[model samples]
Target: MTVLHALAATLSRAGRLARAAASGPDWWRGAALYAAVLALNFVGVWVSIRLIAWNKAFFDALGALDGQTALRQVGVFFLLVSASAGSWLAADWLRKRLLILWRGQLTAQALDLWLGGWAYWQLRPGFGAVPVENPDQRVAEDCRKFVEGLLEFTLDLISGAVALVSFVALLWSLSTFALPACFAGQVTLGGLMQLASAFSQVTTALSWFIFFNRDPAGFVAVCERLDGLMAAARAPAPLPGAPQAILRTASPDGALHLQGLRLATPDGRWLPALPDCTIRPGARVWNSGASGEGKTTLLAAIGGIWLSGEGRIAVPEARFLTLPAGAPVFAEGLAAAACYPEDPATQGSAKLNAVLTRLGLGHRLDTADEAALSGLSMGERQRLGLARAALLRPDWLVMDEATSALDPAFEADLMTWLSAELP
Candidate 1:
């Protein structure tokens, strides 16, 4: 089978490569490797033919009595050497060109597949996706190695097979064919040589198999390593589904509906947000439970961060905004950064200015400097965070102590802004 065919078959059989471990050498993959063996055999036979030719010439020169003629023959040999060297160089150059093109194509395809989706992040920590060790290395180094190895292996097998065939033919012709002796009876050099060569070839073949079968073993070992990494990329299964587990239904206008959302980690498990509760859209719901009540964890579960233990969080078909403790201010322009997740261009300056003014930061519209925002007191940061939320106008905004820094007056003002926009 071709290298492409074997790879396809292996991938198909592996299903979700992340879930199952790869086991044993797939014989189908061995076919292309065997082709490489054939290529190597061809190289061996071709080299052997050159050796035989050199031997013939050396012996003929030794038998010549005239040193002058031998000298002439040596000169001719130099020309022959140069011609052969040039041919070998050209052949090698062609081989490398072909190899590069083949490898480039495979590399591009593998990279595209790997980079697709949140595949990279999914394969990272705490996400339950299988942990691919040294993901960068796998995507960069191993991919290159796989392509090179597959190509070399396949071509070598092809060349080896051709060499084996060619050598057998040449050897048969040279050793076979009946020839009549000048003064004696006819001799069948062909039959004698054929028999001897057959024995020799069989012995050589057996020895080669014993020594070279290690190649396939090594190849499979590499494949297994790659499979191990692939498996590590799959997300761990959701702790066996809860009895009668059901997902909450979301609303049409993108409001978040939280109805008795109760969740607890499984045995021997640790997670935040173990609080059970219900929250309605635009309700200004306050989670007044004490610390460690999993208030933040509750928020996370609702926002779709941790999916391990949960009841149901119905998120309407609208943009959902979850602001953790501190607002993440980027180094970009304050206006642009405030309306993150939505482009400043989309919201426009007028809308941005309105939100900024409402949050009491109207004077810094064109400030462009980040120092102004960063130097703000604690209360100012909360106002900016609120302004950011207002600018985006997300369908659902889940705030975890976002207004903590603001005093009663400012906090009341922030609450008023949120309540006014609730409908």
Candidate 2:
């Protein structure tokens, strides 16, 4: 039962992604590309059928010892081969291009949701009530694989259907021919053909039933990954007044206010409750506590991320940015990473370089290669996180142990720079 449910869910998600790609804004172009591929596939099938006929003619000529006819049939063989190869290659090229195009659309949508709100954070294994595993794989690898599989399977199905119809018709026509008297004592050739066809179809059906009942490993893995991606895309959005224990409202004044605030884990275990208080605009308050003391949870509550809480938290209506303990660094260039969540092109390179320089990440700006970026130390990553905050210059900045990796002196220096630079 669970397996069936998972399969159903996988199909539902796959169908939605496929439909979205097909009906997206560039639907006409996608439709055209698909039609071209399908037409090419049909042409290839026709060439194959023609080659089958050519084989009969060539063999007949060879049996007759007709040199001229045999040579002519060989020439026809080359023509059919050329047509088949050309159509197959063309169709293959178009199919690949279509695969990439659809993958792009699917990846873009997945990314939009993954990065839109607290989804990236909340979908972590232990972060939310319902966690999605290997979200990165879902966005990067699974999207590509899913689209590739969909196309490959669809084309294979079409080819099989066309071949089945053509071959069945040919067989039916040939069944009219009488066999030798010794072979056909009573049963007609048509009856024999019908029986063979029926047996073949029943065997094929049974084989497929057994194949599905056993649950192929590769397909099950794909379905599981698709299910994860679907969950990631549906992760809760970071918005005020979400359906959670907390009731968030917009502050009329430019201040952060908490009233009757209480916190709890997703499992319903209560945490230290925050006393009713207000942090007015321009207040540089810091939350400090030992590890596992709910300081980070408090920050999450203030940021509208931790939903398992009851409170009337009022936040100012402004651009908000949160810097977690380990800020994310993208494979995109240093400049882009520094000004993340915002287009790097919109920000001047000089400003980006200066921010990184201020944060002591200037030396690392030369390389945007992912491998090089991966080697960044914890301190350097925190500095980059600060650089993002600096570049974005949000009206409200929430740091949850964001500078924990840096030495005291450097952290203090960065803090001073932030205070001087931001309001």
Candidate 3:
């Protein structure tokens, strides 16, 4: 069963690679560069063979004590040497070009799929999708190594195949050189040597890469990780526990509906269940309870973002945004962080300054540089989050104690501000 699954996965991966190659930019793709590099490499091998023949002639001239012939052979030696060196240099250049093109093409596609449809968010540890550790390494370094090693192996294979086919004929033509007549003439020992040489090259190359190097393992690990990321992203939301747990994507505005709503823990157990209820549009509502109560869970359920357990939530398809108790600030500068989810320039600097001042971040009115936001305390960050929400004015804002980090008076002031601003 595992073998069969492995075969299926290999085929799927190959198909995906083929499609990516086809879809990539026509002029700048890796395959075309690789093909050109392969041709240049074959030329290099052919030049190398010529240089070997040049060696024989140059030595024969010296053995015969022919200064003229030896001098001529010296010039022939230099010519072949230059040609071989040029071929090697060109092939090396093209091989590197192929690496970058392939890495860029693959990494861009992987990032697109990984970030598609909010998969990055959903694939967190406690979220529905399976978490992928070291995703940054997987995307950046893994993509680079995968492309580099694949191109290296592929070029070597092509070179070995070309050498086997062409050099065997060259060997057959030179059968008079060293091999016994019975072997080279009757059994074709020279051709056999060529085949052995090609086979040995392949064996040595693959053995070194797989056994003595880390690239093969890295390639396999990256492949499996990227495959899992795609699989998790493509997975559908879990089915509702029963017909009672209906999911509404588009309901009328301000009409929050909940029927037998049950929120499940990450492990699939129903932890907090809410009875049927409706909070109509424009309703002034406050939900309070101890830590174990379903207050936060209820908000998640009502927002139609919670996926587990039994019940229906008919929340409107309005511009819904949630502000968690611990608000997140980015390192994208004060203005950018404050105006997140909307471009900072959309609202003018004056309005942003007013909101920041109201949220007690008035000192940051002139702070637009990208110094790390890590210096901001939790409460200060929450203040920025509130400022962001206030500036954007979302239609259905769900606050999960978004003001919890603030002092009591400031918390009350922020809540009142939310009520006046959001309503």
Candidate 4:
């Protein structure tokens, strides 16, 4: 029951996971390998059937004490055993390989759904209708479990069905049935038919219990989480009565405009409303307040990623960049992280190398850190975020306490660099 519970939960996500993977051509290529694996597994099952016959012959020779026959049977037994073993081993290897590929595809699908179209952003507090907890597990661990579980159950079912069919045929061929004369007189059905019907009723009831009432609590838990994430990913462009013009393309002249726009919490409660403020192009304006003053919320609303806000905001598109409080770093190496939100390849190696050097990431340039960029301190993450802004050369840059982590001197140096470097 424990195993069934675990399997049902994981397999619940398999259909959606496979659909996500099948969206691309690479996963389809994996399907061909899947067919090959099935063929190999069936061939192994056939070998087992042959081995069962060899078992009878070998035992008969031994029972007769026939030395010549026993020796020949020994040779035959070895051949059958070797064939079955080889077939099983080969099929096992193929199944494992298939598992790896299938799991990889499923994982990639989950990532794309979570990351693409700002889905990750909306799942944050005050942005989504559904609360998604431990999305990390859903995207990583659950996907692994789902792929492995589905393959295990699917293959076992296939092999068991094949073996059952073979055994039933053998039994039918070798068996003879008889009944008491009185019983035969009372029932028109033959003894074999009566036996078959009785066995069928028992097996059918057992199978029904196994199939329809199988525990699915584990799968249900995952399904609810994934469904929430899916809802977040499919979240509509704007909430009810959201002014379309306000969410339109940013002002062309690099001006930031706010007209009666009020920032709200996730549940549509007003946090702090902007009293119609405007920042002229190239003007230096500062927004400051005590803690919980909705500073970050304001920044998000202006950036257009926050749908919890109401009213109007006009900001730039590509020329606008936001340096949020926390640096968003990916696992792709240092160069990629520095040029994030923009392809690293577009910035030549020499240019990226120079930016890292100028931003005091020269040591990182050598390390070429290809991991998650997790080892970096708060200050280091801030530096990388700033470096990205400089590289992008955005006409409009919004910093929400982006420089708070760095020392005053370093912060001054960064502001000075940006002033000198950006137009």
Instruction: Provide backbone clash counts, one per model.
Output: 27, 0, 2, 3
Give Cα-based local distance difference scores for all models: 0.56, 0.74, 0.68, 0.68
Decoy 1 TM-score against native: 0.50
Best by lDDT: 2
- Runs of candidate 2 exceeding 4 Å displacement: 1-14, 20-23, 55-69, 129-131, 175-217, 232-243, 325-337, 342-390, 402-417
Candidate 2's residue-wise lDDT over 1-423, tens digit each? 998997787678668778755666777877888889989988976775665456557766766688999899889989999998999999999999898888888788778778876677766655565567778887788787777777876775676577556655654554454244326585433345444553454344344434533224665476567656666557653333323668989998889899998887655667777789999877888777667768888888888777877879998998988898887888876777788778987888888788888888788777655654777888888888888888888888888889989889878988999988887
Rank the candidate models, highest TM-score first.
3, 2, 4, 1
Summarize candidate 3's per-residue lDDT along 285-383 as a digit string, tens digits.
778878876688677666554556676677776787788887777767788888887899998989988888888788865555655464788898888
Which has the better TM-score: candidate 1, or candidate 4? 4
In model 2, the clashing pairs are none
Model 1 error, position 261 (Å): 2.5
Determine the C-alpha RMSD for candidate 1 after optimal superposition of all C-alphas: 9.6
Highest-scoring model, TM-score: 3
- Model 1 CA deviation exceeding 4 Å by range: 1-148, 166-235, 238-248, 252-254, 266-283, 325-392, 401-423
TM-score of 4: 0.72
lDDT of 1: 0.56
| Superposed Cα deviation of residue 68, candidate 1 (Å) | 18
Model 4 CA lDDT for position 6: 61
